[model samples]
Target: MSSVRKIVSTLVFAALTITSFQPALALSRVKDLVEVEGIRENMLVGYGLVTGLNGTGDSLKNAPFTQQTIQTMLERMGVNTRGQTMQTKNTAAVMVTAKLPAFASTGNNIDVSVSAMGDAKSLQGGTLLVTTLFGADGQIYALAQGPVAIGGFSAQGDAGSVTRGVPTAGRIPNGAIVEREIGFNLAAERSLKLSLRNPDLTTAARIASAVNTYVGSPVAVASDPATVRLAIPADYKGGVVGMLTDIEQVKVATDQSAKVVVNEATGVIVMGSDVRISTVAIAQGNLTIKVTETPEVSQPGPLSNGTTQTMPRTKIDIDEGKGKRMIVMKEGVSLQNLVDGLNALGVGPRDIISILQAIKAAGALQAEIQVIG
Candidate 1:
């Protein structure tokens, strides 16, 4: 009985020791925070016209295209203006644009944006005409037409013009109807590929292992750190969507590269999550200079027929501030500790950037440094 108890105790101690020194468990599930690939929104564009504006419409003299369109529209309403020239006020020409949401259905209404393309002063009080929206293939994907809802107002005078926001552009709520649907066939793929936002070998291998263990089969394999190839199985052959739905729900640990980001113009600094440094010492120095200019007049002694002359005088000065708090950063330190040590010296953000560069130059920092405006 005593020997059996001792054996059990030794096994328990060994298990605890191994667990303590093991690597950090990254997200063990499958999917990332964002969608991988072939899953996004589509853009649709169209041309249209706006009417019902107060005299602030397109000028027929400048935009003949507007006049021609109006004429054609009027003729369609049984008005004969083939050779007759009829001008109408309170109308504007505009271009319409909208984003087709992912997996849009036919006959579904969506919002559209309308912008005046002519010399119209405002589209605040206007209604858009029906226009067909086309995709990249020039095929009609949707139809847009609705009342304009300009959020700004404009007033003009001989002295100046004052306007806020964009009076020439406005959005119409549910003014466009989807006439066509883009095909997104996930089931058609006998095998699916999972692409990672970042490429990391450790993460890819972990994902392949987790999927195989969870599903009890080797359905997922890592092609590279950034791409994972998944085979469609028999149970999930006709259920690709279902399988993906389950796969995306699984979480995987994310790994980032070792990098240091600095913004000089805005004085911003960001340390990468995985940055580490070796045993290196860092020292920062600053230099400042000042120059002053003054003028003086030199007169001839006792006015001995000599003209007074003006002389330019200058003074130069340099003041070096004494170093404060010579801080020491140890080797193999984490980013959090490193930044905390620097911040303890009350280093300004811009100065921090300079110090970091100096550290990189001295081979102390083992991470990439990026500067942005």
Candidate 2:
């Protein structure tokens, strides 16, 4: 019995030691917290024409640009329609857009979004023609041509019309093929910068510390609250790519300033876990006043020559909210306690918004209040 007791005690001690070294549950990987500087997507845009629109295309008289585009396209195809008054309802002018992903190679396919630029009723069952997508530098990078897939439909008669979803927008999967690649050499770079999505001084320092601990050297430095500069170590064999791959997986506990965001239009409230309040007294109530009008008809006697008149009777009542009382909140109250206390007062989101704003003005709320539409 004595030998078994000793083994159990040793196992319990080891388990406790391991648990103490484990990362916190709220910790996030470095990759999720920061984005590499140079690796990003580029936007590509182009003007194109969609055919087979089933009479939902732009009107040539209303949209003169569409007519001019059609004339230009016909002339390229060895057809002359400049002098002719052509009325075609089977085509639409559309804007094609796509995002060229990082490290994209030639012949790689990407999805494209198509939006009608003219007064076209719908884009369903339409096939986009060969459109050349261009980058910001005026260089052609991709070619898009595919059947447009719209999510909604539009149907109309003489009296009414029924439309669901957006009929003027659609998407085509694997519609664009890359013809040129953006010049970027990640492996050849000696250093890189990591930009935090949410800038925080403590979080940036923690990230730098975590990276240095992983590399067993002080190669990473927190240049600012929003950026971390990393110098590749000489002994790391994986180059820049390998260094990023290893360091991005390092977990770090993120910290932020306490803030409360409220959307007035939506009546939605969001409070951070770090939000707190000093000891404060709060009382919320509404004073209601109601007025009702009742009309009565007054008729003269049968013998007398008099006309009937309508008389108005009004009743007014006022309520001062006598049932509500003031409540005291202790200092260092957490987010959960604040919410529970507010709910106990029977106030809704709109009322809560007003109460929070009032608390902020009273210098009792320790967090910053941000009001959005």
Candidate 3:
């Protein structure tokens, strides 16, 4: 440990030793700790149209699909437009999608996303037409229709154009109403089953023991590392609501597996608290390549009346830093210890990113690297 943190830790330990009570480690809530098995979100998707666009719609000449779809919709409405080519400039084809949460009932409103499916330049100030969203079973479960809230804008001029965010996609808050519900009898089961989000043999055993101790009976059983089944008492047999309320408050420490997350896109790294590393040395270096362009005017002749042409000039350069700085890390060290050791060399976040990556490559880093774009 660094001298500063070591001293602070020493002081804290001495104070805790004298105090009658000490702070305990914080634990996650039971609801946050486990997930109900067999329950999941529902995906609903559909093809629809966006109207009210100011000439930013699909060109029917190039997007025959859009024209065909419109014709089909009209025909369904008892209108015959067959063989009649349409040159519409006020409509855009779109895909509407939304997620229905588990246990969602009729009339539940869900936010929907509408994205342009054709070559519609923009969906700005457009309203989504009545769209039926269906599940994988081809059953329509939701109806979505509302004014789209495009998150961007676009403007054009003879010389250039300006655009911001994304104009071809938009969102409608609470735009879909659920017309069906997925059946899942959670309280009707003979016994309660708790599924761990990250199942561990030790954690499953602990949960089973805790539940059994609270009920004054050996009713909870660790069926597997990922599950713990509990038998409901006769008094609370069908009244699972009360039993869950009581069990959810019981504190049970959990153990997590060792993992390392690295974001390659943003050069961010996250290591599990339990991650360990053996002694190893690592070196890191930074290399940069730069390119520049210079436009030159070429005159046909010194003062002769001739057209002057433009020639492009380019230059390239490279800047290579010194040899990698070797860092030695021992096993079983905490995150704070690792941070301190790296910071001691005045390494910033950007530099530490490269150093950690190199360390992992040399088999010195025990954590995983995840790249996030």
Clashing residue pairs in candidate 1 are 27-253, 29-251, 30-250, 30-251
Q: Give the CA lDDT, 0 to 100, for residue 347 in model 3.
A: 66
- Tens digit per residue, CA lDDT, model 2, 233-325: 767978898999998999999999999999999999999999999999999887889999998999999999999999999999998777777
lDDT of each: 0.82, 0.94, 0.82
Best by TM-score: 2
Global Cα RMSD, each model: 6.6, 4.1, 8.1
The digit string of per-residue lDDT tens for model 3 on 152-182 reads: 9899999999999999999999999999888
lDDT minimum window of 10 residues, candidate 3? 20-29
For model 2, state the Cα shift of residue 115 in Å. 0.6
lDDT of 1: 0.82
Residue-pair clashes per candidate: 4, 0, 8
